[model samples]
Target: MKYVQLGNSGLIVSKLAFGAMTFGYGNIPSVYKVGQDQSQELVDRALAAGINFFDTADAYADGQSEEMLGRLLGARRKETVIATKAGNRMGPGLVQSGLSRKHLFDACDASLARLNTDYIDLYIVHKTDPFTPLEETLGALNDLVRQGKARYIGYSNWPAWMAAQAVQIQHERRWATFINGQMYYSLVGRDIEHDTVPFMNNCGVGLTVWSPLAGGFLSGKYTRDNLSDPNNRLSGFDFLPLDKEWGFTVLDAVREIAQNHSATPAQVSLAWLLSQSHVCSVLVGSSKPSQLDDNLSAVDLQLTSEETAKLNELTRPVPLYPNWFTTMTLDGRVVEALK
Candidate 1:
């Protein structure tokens, strides 16, 4: 696995991160039912593959995910860069959720204890909380960094406008700011390109992609002839709001590219993501070790310029509002230079 900086931070991390969301027994059997034995084996395989970055969250499997990951990593925890998130509903109490100071402080301790670590390599706010001020959330994160509870901070699933505001506040306050962002990005889900991509690029926030295969929709397991597979992860968790017909259309192109490169659909999809300059890492989760191995192989598969452009055009997101207007107003020479 190739290594890179976790955003602009001095810290180094693997380009392919192992997502431990599938470590514990989740609500769905396919997701949460993996036992400790299997998790250990998978963890061993990941380490062997040179995947040092492991991502989990407090909300995954009522925190069982952290426990399983901690237990599996055991003595090898020191060799890995563990990233986990907070700000999700962890309890029934009104104070149990959100990015308030109370929850963040308590949540950090809980995550540390669960992960069996003294400090989190990266602590993230899982989602935005309208009720709590960004100041409060960022301040708490800064304190955690200062206290050595979390070494770096970031946010997940946040809009660009709010994220830009957070970046400004952190810089102005001289507090610990964002280092990386973990978001759902795939060939079928390219909406973040309009705003989030530009903002992260300008602000120096790195992106680590989640669900890079659209929950297995781009794994070449689903086709027009076989739209529904009980064995597929999407059958249990179809969280991504992707149109099946559109996904199949995208899959057709991915499949064609895969054949030309002598690779799998999933490899082609992941390789396409790695081609993006703004992407720092891609998180690949799996219930089986073989699936993880397939994803790991993508780092070695290089797509040609023509293939990359074909996928780019096929999956390019439509420009939004002022972005389109801004492009329209650009000088022809400037456009030519960009081309």
Candidate 2:
């Protein structure tokens, strides 16, 4: 039910964004089997729980996700902040993908059609397109805003350096800059802390975290003994790359904290992310109503400082080269004084 402004933008969004990746049936039949009826029920539950932010992508379920979300939202489309992504191959043709001007325009129009909406609340580039010039991509996105096709633009799965450069270009051109960055961030996958977090902090950009459960490893269903559950997405998809040993160690801490609070491990894991100040929202997708309910309840689960510290220590990322060198050479007294 909590809301926050997305980065420095005026747009206010729910802290927990309902991801519509499971809205339609497609290639991953096992993972995304929720049909229209079930999708509606899940959406209803999410809305009832005060979740106004909904996220989907044209690439998810081969565009079925956007179609189903559109159909379910129906009259309530204007009540929610809907976000979708492009730059992913929606078809087999080479021209059907990337952040090229042609692809971005075509994809945005198609998404609008599928979602049955006039303008997207947020349009993100799903992934980087090295072959296309950054200017081409940024210019096309800016044009979308100018034409009223999209209200805002963002990028996902992009390197920190690339995002910084794009922001600078947009600033120089006096165009609409990105308000947020969606990336994989979890207790087990703290890789974003190295550069992405610092870059976003410097640029005043918010973060939307995907796969906060570390592919279900932090969902409390997986253990050292039961690591292969056929029904679990991690067992089949394994999308987010993580250190299993480190993940399990963090899971143990989460399990302990969950027991103390009488909350589900999933809730504890999500609460850890929700407690972060820079994170604007955490995306949670589910095929079942109960799963959605569980995720929504995480907004209410406040972890104690002691518990948060334990989890943070257990899952903290190892400082990389420059960070380590700076910390080692810098004078602690001077840094303390500056702080």
lDDT of each: 0.91, 0.91
Steric clash pairs (candidate 2) = none
- Worst 10-residue stretch by lDDT in candidate 2? 224-233
**Where does candidate 1 clash, by residue pair?**
25-32, 26-32
Tens digits of lDDT, candidate 1, 1-339? 898998778878999999988877767876777778888888899999999999999989999999899888889988889999999999999999999999999999999999888999999999999999889999999999999999999899999999999999999999998999888899999999999989998988999998898888899987776666677666788878987888788888889989988899999999999988889999998888888889999999999999999989988888889999998898999778999
Q: Which candidate ranks first by lDDT, i.e. highest?
A: 2
- Predicted structure 1: clash tally: 2
lDDT of candidate 2 over 1-339, digit per residue (tens): 999999989999999999998777777765678888889999999999989999999998888999999988999998999999998897889999999999999999999999999999999999999999999999999999999999999999999999999999999999989999999998888999999999999998889999888777788888777677676677767767777877787788888899999899999999999998879999998888988898888999999999989888887889999989987999889999999
Off by over 4 Å in 1: 229-231, 333-339
For all predicted structures, in order, the TM-scores are: 0.96, 0.97
lDDT of 2 at 81: 95
Which candidate number maximizes TM-score? 2
Indicate the residue-level lDDT of 268 in model 2.
99
